[model samples]
Target: MANIDSTAAIHSHQSWIGIVQIITAATCWGTLGIFSTYLNQMGFSGWQVTILRIVTAAVIVLAMLPTLWPQLMKLSARQWFGLAMQSIVGVLGMSVCYFFAVSYVGAGPAVALLYTAPVFSLLFSKFLLSESITRKSIALAFMAVFGVGLTMLGEQAEVNWGILLGLASGMCYSLYGVLGKRAMHDAHPAPLVFFTSVVISACGLLLLPETYQTYTQLLTLPLSTWGYVLGLSLLGTVVPFGLYMKALEKLPASRASVFTIFEPLTAIALAMILLHQALSWIQYLGVTLILLAALLNAVVNGTTTRVPRWLKRRQTV
Candidate 1:
């Protein structure tokens, strides 16, 4: 009917908007390395940087809490627990691993390794969400794994802990997406983001006992360093995350994961231009393969609408 057609049209439009929002978010996230590097140069440890960045973002998001309080108050204890776990494990855990990975291996490779998140996401979607995994998904997974191998091979003779940390970060990041997809069904994006930020900040505090010393050091930091932290918090963390959560409300986590390819691409480009870091040709090829696999996976998964009968029954339990 006409109403059905109108609803379809609206959904199509929203889908496009979601795509734009996620891509924009990925682009902003790509700059994380640059800001992180700057913070490192200012003598901030990875943990210190993570805490500062997250705390700043928490403050920014908390400013909106007054308006969001009504919706937040409506969440049940179970929903609150779900969001807390998502924030602690997904956001806080991922950030710690990722920032340390960046510290060890530099931004470009760290981001490249983090792109493996899509592969993890695919698997999580299969097992956790009970989404169907086609033969093509399996094929693309192999391709992406091969690409990861190529990237590691291109790293030369050095033993880098960053690779492991990056992979862990990717896995954690995928878990975040998967859990967040579930949480989104019960809450609005703004309140969800605010509470997650609060959890991250709280966890950061618990992890670092010398928080007062770090705050004291902050007083002596140059204005430029302060600006970088603010930029990292607002642009890199809050804005991108808010946009990404909004996007997730409109797109499946699997399809939304593909758009994150913009993250590494932007990071690689920025690394080369700003930091003057260059990857070997082989590594470039590897990055290309990874991206292609992500696109292919998105194409394969996006075409389906039917859930398996077993998954349907599982949902009821």
Candidate 2:
């Protein structure tokens, strides 16, 4: 029994390490937006930007195939299909919509709208997972929404179709996050990411138009653009998510979700640094409120509590 307890304690410590890894991953993922703007300024089409991101990231994943192939071969068809869907929703769908929305509108409002993910995640948990709806969740949702509105600061009356696109992207990403929790079960995180990258890359390469005439343009891209794109693909996509799954293995979905508030915060800070986009006092206050709400929600749904739906589903399975 003493030996058993010792092993359990060691496992617990490892799990904490995983939590830290995921937070680091989330922060890196947030910086992708800043890079996207640079890509846009260089006259790259949205599809071109998406293709490079997926293809480059996929190459990194495929490089690990010697170690990853055995796990891929062992997966059930259902699991493989689920992983494919994760790629579609989480990578392809999220990227296509987000880039277009950012282009159509602007990054500040685009990000504010996209931060609606947590509220939608809670809703999906209630509907799909059959988790209980709590007053605390509702309050957090309200606070988050309000923060978005406050950030807009009387600009709500100027809403347009681009705003709708941003909201749709947020909704899609929310579902992606909720579904990812289940689809990732019993899978190797690195391979899962690799497979997702491959699928998204293949789809983009096949579907999106590639102009060979301007293909040489890519080679001549300014050093800064090359640096940003590489940064986006490496730090933004590969390394961060590689760490996120490790952290998710240790942390609860709800708790892990809270750390994502940093995603927008990082983007905001980067914008200020790279673009010198100044935030109004009202916008800063709104950001603070949203961050506070996220913290409150995380505290209220501590890691110890079993997500009601996951608990019930585990029993049924």
Q: Which candidate number has the best lDDT?
A: 1
Our tally of clashes for model 1 stands at 0
Local distance difference test values of all predictions, in order: 0.79, 0.70
Q: lDDT tens digits, residues 64-115, model 1?
A: 7677778777878888787887787777778878888888877887787777
Pick by TM-score: which candidate is best? 1
Using all chains and alpha carbons, the TM-scores for the candidates as numbered come to: 0.85, 0.81
